[model samples]
Target: MAANTDETTDAELVAEIARQVPDASADEAAAIAVAIGAHLTDRQRAAAAAAAAAGSEETWDGKEWSFSGRIDATQKRHVRVRQESPTDPWSAAGRTDRM
Candidate 1:
């Protein structure tokens, strides 16, 4: 929880960041939110694209992706991960070590 940015004052921005990346650090979430606020900047676009492409077969609830897959490595950053990267029958778009 470290938001040293002036944008933190905006409750909407903070909430949106939390909604998108709940586990993200305040600073990381803020940076992501700010970039996303700007009509989806390069980083934001890449992240969204990765999310969309990863769980193309899953259902999205506007936030996290829901898919039927075996447990695999979790990730902190949003990036493209190939389906065959893991030998598992299916791999989740993303997972977390914490609940």
Candidate 2:
């Protein structure tokens, strides 16, 4: 079968399920993952459409960086981040807790 391009495959999903439920047998994990995926397929499609419609973007100006996007389908969110130095990790720029 062709590999999944945009989402995890059943095998990958089963593996993750098995990892989370160590006591479950491989067959059991596979069955559960398949069922969950089937049940959520329509909801997943709707979420993808909503996220695409909401859109997101990231911008950088020297050390300052900003991202504007929906944190989830239900709300729009923005996050400002900064890098102290060329090698520094990006960090929340200001009071992002309220953002």
Candidate 3:
């Protein structure tokens, strides 16, 4: 006869992973998520890496800046771009390809 059994779900797996990396920050958690996602498919890994690299921003002269901010429930804007203009003339050409 077949016996009833319990199985671990993807959420359970992720939670187990998170439990293992207790010291991980929010960013680290996201990286771990991508890595786990990558193991499932090669295309997903490449896409995750590309997305990670593309989101990295640096100053005009190649200097990187660290920033942090948040919006409360009163103002729930998904994205905010703070550039000099719609067409940022100061940005180096060819950098657009990175995205």
| RMSD in order of candidates | 19.5, 15.8, 19.9
| lDDT leader | 2
For each candidate, give its TM-score against the true structure.
0.27, 0.34, 0.27
Question: Lowest-scoring 10 consecutive residues by lDDT in candidate 3?
Answer: 63-72
lDDT of 3 by residue, 1-99 (tens): 112123223565566667889988655665666565556556676899999888774433322211112222223433332343123433422233232
Question: Per-residue lDDT of 1-99 in model 2, one digit per residue for the tens?
Answer: 112335554787898999999999998887777668666776788899989876742334543432323222224554444332222223432334544
TM-score of 2: 0.34
- Candidate 1, run of 10 with poorest lDDT: 63-72
Per-model lDDT: 0.49, 0.56, 0.46
User: Per-residue CA lDDT of candidate 1, range 19-67, in tens?
Assistant: 8777888777766666555543456778989998987754334223222
**Model 2 steric clash total:** 0
lDDT score, candidate 1: 0.49
The candidate, 1 or 3, that scores higher on lDDT is 1
**Residue 87, candidate 2: C-alpha displacement in angstroms:** 62
Error of 1 at 15 (Å): 1.8
